[model samples]
Target: MTSHSFSKFWSTDLTRDSLLSLLDTPTLKSLRLVNRAFAATTSRQLFRDVYITFRSSTFTKPARMAALERIGWNIRSVTFVINHGAEMFLPPLLDPLTGEEVCFVFTPCVRTTTPTSSPTAPASGSTSTAAGERQGVYGTWEMTDLLVKQYPPLFHAAMNVSSFVAALTHMPALRHLKVSCAGQESTHRYRRSVVDYALSSLRIAIEQAPLPRLEALSLTPIHPGGIQYLCPMAGIGSLPNSCRRWTQIRRLEIHMDTFPFDKGQATDHLKLLHSYLQAFRALRDFKFRWVGDGHKGPSPLSLATEPALCELASRSQACPKTRHYLRPLKFPYLQYMVLGNAVLDASQVSDFLTEHRHSLLEFDFEQVSLRSGTWDDALAPWRTLSSAEYDAAWGEKQPAEVEVMEVPFVLGPSPEESPATSSPEQYSKRRKKKKKKRHARTTEVAVNNDLFASTAAMLLEEEPVHRGSLNFRTLREGLSNWARSKGMFWGHGHGHGHGSSHDYLHKAVQSPILV
Candidate 1:
């Protein structure tokens, strides 16, 4: 039998797991060439992740589009990467007084003249230029309008949107859609306009068709209005009715690229947030972050400063701006709440936590400035719940006590840090000397280890830990030895990975080293 025939038979007989074990892309692509049987088995994996990049040279070409069109059915995830310069024309807003198009920005006029004896000369009626002109005689805005309207297929505009949507609609099995536009567009005033346009297109496309399997979405919007555009409100920007179709989405992450700069007043922003959050009913994990510019960590509260935060935190009463909007929020299905770089009113936040305490498993607030020393006060509602109340609601007994033991263990420098030397003998001596030092420290800490192990073993037999600390290094080392000497105790603790907190706590009570 030929090698191809043998491989074909082998591929057909292999289990799904076996086929998936072949990790390299080239190998998977080659398997499709082996035979129809191999092709059938491998095609799903080959086209699972589809990436469409929008660039000046490649966006117009139909090769990538054709491939995507053919195999879009196999796509499970699709990512759209738009280039920096791809921008849409923002038609001049009409002036109320003159009722004429008035330029919002100061843009210089650019005139063009046809060259003599050029084969690609302007048409008889035409004033000037090629289709892909970087700058038109009128200006960048005019150039953008020309490209988007005249040669829509060649530019990242409505045509691109329609094509992308068509491709997405073709994939019935798609679960993830990510639209990323990095860097500012030179022609456009708002760098986020490209992202806004892309999302708007997707929203329109989604309204027309059904994406039953889509459950996760990720995108970065530079403007606050872009979010409003993506999920349009019903009446007076109250409820986002357009996002009703996205109820199937369980995970939504919005990256606000220029948050502090673009953000509105705290109340106005929070009102917008309340409207947006109400749109997703079945969402489990929601993350909204403002990726600061140039700062290493989270952006400083530029708009929502410390004093304002303190004022908000000082009172349990919700902000007047968002009081009505946030009063109704009780995300029963939410499991993870990760918010960063944005300030939320303390009272509203407390109310949210109290309402969702039973459902929320993990809550993270990174660089979220609040009134100084008010974090505990903000989370007080959750802590104030009685043990009986917790058990009644969650069907799990809360830990009655907490033990904190600090076991000191020396964290010496790594033994592998040998000094640089010209002589091999010198290098060998340095290594030996480091090993001797480590051994001495280890020997000296032998008594400390015994003390650590005994404490851990004793704590294992006690009631569930409410809140406590032990030297992590000592606990890790001592626990292993203690487990061997005394049978492993199932420590009553949170986040034991059994999925349900009830199940985890139940098992903790039922089983004896409680981690």
Candidate 2:
């Protein structure tokens, strides 16, 4: 076996497709171990796209990164599955009449940073070496400055932001990056504040690191257990004022989980998310997904049963009102968009598409519910779909909100402490500081960087969603008179999407506001 054996084998012993098929069985593992040349040849095919859980027991990250190092350059994309916790304190949920599983775990966050049109085909059964199986592949790329993640109970975080930052160094040729946030079980070592640390570190990593080839970013929300409901799972609004706009990103995808069992309070973090999204001026493709009603059972698919983070009814308190969440969002370079599991008015969706009609080529709708107007009425801006109908508005045609954060300002300039890492004394001091005259610094329009921060409350804007009208029956009808009349073009319009921030990070971070 030799380096050139792959092409030779393809022509003689195997075809490229057959060799790739060997990847799924035990035979592939044996073939790689037969000889170094065989290993190298197989590795080029095996380690193309990498997924790391960072679930290592060894204190040093060298053991964890060793496998990634072997095929560092061989890697084209990487996914870091941060194991944050999920909620457990809510009451029970009334089962849906049907037995199908319901979930708030929208899995789109795990999508690789490749185009949905032509995604990078994965090497079947690819994986890094188990830590103890062989001598470690240490620092081949020579990243001496890679900051190691601390492992003490107080310092540990499921999100493992430190490990993620360290992992970024090895992925030089990386194009797409995904941080799929989740945790199934609770641990005493975990701290709620640690979520902020992970997000802030993420922003810093992207801003400071030289990801010259990086193009896509995707984030799923975080929902953890114990009784404290994590207001909004880590999403765009979590980034503080100091975080910078990531102009390098051309694609953006966000997967959001709705409050289980109940809608919780009246807050609109989605609007804040839309506000944050405008910073990515270079974005071309966008996708948003939501999965609600995950509280139907005890599994990860259904974590809570009562209501948001927790039930206020049991605590005897009233939920407060907040402003609307969704508005027309614009992207200068957006050519395509995909939206799912959302609630919107026909006007908002039509307005957004009309706004982007010049730059956008086409947009797809899935599992979306309209609050008012018919599909035929809402999509009228484009008049008719000539081709999958390129429209100008590459944005959301929905209404949304959640997690009322106290609207935090960056505290001076030290990166906030990881929840598990911070001591009680530090937590107490920060809590006291927050209790004091914090709003004194807040202004009518707290101009942080992009948008204003409004703490003022508004009347309840609870409009009933047309559950019947949520489906895009007409959009998928392909070529039909009714569908065409309602702006359905040629092929069924589908979507794709994929964000980071720092600075306010060196400062302390704020937990999202929950009712």
Report how far residue 20 has shifted in candidate 2, in Å. 2.6
Reference-based lDDT, residue 386, model 1: 78
In the range 50-114, model 2's lDDT, one tens digit per residue, is: 77653333212455567655677777777766555432112222224553432211111112221
List the lowest-lDDT window of 10 residues for candidate 1.
110-119
Q: In candidate 2, where is summed lDDT lowest over 10 consecutive residues? A: 451-460
Tens digit of per-residue lDDT, candidate 1, span 141-205: 45455434433332343323334455555687889877675665323433334445555555655
Best by TM-score: 1
- What lDDT does the true structure give each of the candidates? 0.55, 0.46
| Per-prediction TM-score | 0.53, 0.48
lDDT of 2: 0.46
Off by over 4 Å in 1: 1-15, 18-22, 55-66, 86-156, 159-161, 185-195, 220-223, 232-241, 261-273, 294-328, 344-348, 388-515
